[model samples]
Target: MQMMEYYFGLISVVAQSSENVLFLVKPILPIMLRIIAPVLGVVVIAAFAGNVMQVGLRFSTKPIQPDFSKINPNPVRFITKMLFSRQSVMNLGKSVFKIATISVVAFFLVKKDLFWIMKTMDMGVLQAFQLCLLLAFKLIMVVSGLLLILAIPDYFFQRREHTESLKMTRQELKEERKLLEGDPLLRARMRERQKSYAKRRMIQEVPKADVVITNPVHFAVALKYEPLRMGAPECVAKGQDLIAQRIKKIAEENDVSVVENKPLARELYKRVDIGDEVPEDLFTAVAEIIAFVYKLKQKEAVNV
Candidate 1:
């Protein structure tokens, strides 16, 4: 319709003037630009808006990235496969159906309008032209609307197909999981090594302790205190069951005082970590223990 308008305008301008070709060209250029510019602008804006509505403002270079491995030098094989593929056949069928449906609809619309126009033979040329323009505009809108409706199903199908194509196989999924969380066997070994190192360090600290407080058999906590170096007695090592036995053995070997205080031992093991001072609530209990251990050491030193 816009093209027809441009052509009609050009003809009207030329018909009014017996001017030279150069003079005609000047008027024709401006009229052509005026008729074409708005239509072109509307088309460009509509295309951009439709794309934005479908997939909003995303920037990705993956689509444009070169993958030379996918390129086939032999065009014949590629073309044959492309044309005969199931997807290709389906697309061809859909295209043919759309074209046929739209053609049938457009033919009936034009035929009906033409019949009406012919019946009113006394209508002026300008009025007939206006009616024809209105019919053309309606035809364009109806066709576009039908195509847009058809495109919705195609969009969903394409999205599902793309997602399915990108799905990983079982082996691929396993490999990806390993990459994310590390190999199971290797992680188990790492945890075992960490536990062993911590146990060794705890055993080494037991011999340097001033006193080993015990839950008699269930729990053991070894503490060390130095007035000049530490503010309060700090648990140097703590353990339960077999580990408690090991701590007690090391303390005995080093001649460290072993005290049976089930409540204090359990409380210190639960509340104080290795290298941390006993809590303020246990200050009086720990102070008396430390003072007794110091007195015992002083008596032993005097006898030696």
Candidate 2:
């Protein structure tokens, strides 16, 4: 429709000019380039914008990969199956619907304009030409708007269908996991070895603790302090449940003081980590506990 309007305008310009056909022929190449440039520019921009909006920026050579199987000459098994596919059927239906709708719209518009033109028979040639152009523009706008509305749903459906088609089976998922994470047994053994080393290091630190605060059974937090070497008590080891039992047992063997302070033990276990200082809010309570433990140790030393 746009090309038709452009051709009409070009003809009108040429008709009004005093130049002969031979003279116009000399500059036809430049005129043709001017007309083709905008059309090509619009097509290129539309193609790029449509792809970007649908899938963003993606680089894939899969579509262009050579596949000899696709060149099968069997029409019933290959070509016919593709022709009768769901997507092909849907596209055919959409094309037919668009053609029917546009035809109906153009028929009514032309009918209305024809009646107006007939009623005003004395209208000038230029006026009649302008009226036809106006009608053509309106018809094009209506058809383009309808097609654009239809295209939005089709684009989303195609994207969703494509995604579902790419879903992996259980076997494929297992293969991908093996490729990415290596052998399961080997990974598990490595994890266990790491935990064993960490637990041994934690047990070694427990002997250096000045006091082991306990939630009595569930939680344990070991704190160490030195007047000359440290400013405040720092947690040396902390654990719960089985690890807590192990920490208390190791402290007992080392003759470290284990004080039962449920509230302080639970708070330190939750808030403080190994090698971290106790929070300022718990400074006074922790200081009193440390002082009591120190006094007990001094008295035991004097008795010995």
Tell me how many residue pairs clash in candidate 2. 0
Model 1 score (lDDT): 0.86
TM-score of 1: 0.56
Q: Which stretches of candidate 1 lie over 4 Å from their true place?
A: 1-138, 145-188, 302-304
TM-score of each: 0.56, 0.48
Clashing pairs in 1: none
TM-score of 2: 0.48
Give the lDDT of residue 88 in candidate 1.
Answer: 88
lDDT of candidate 1 over 26-127, digit per residue (tens)? 766887799789989998998888777665777899889999988999899899889988778878998998999899989888887887668546764456
Root-mean-square deviation of candidate 1: 9.4
> How does each model score on lDDT?
0.86, 0.85
Can you write out model 2's per-residue Cα lDDT over 120-206, one digit (the tens) per residue?
467655566677667777887877787788779878987997797799989999989988998798899999999889878888999
Best by TM-score: 1
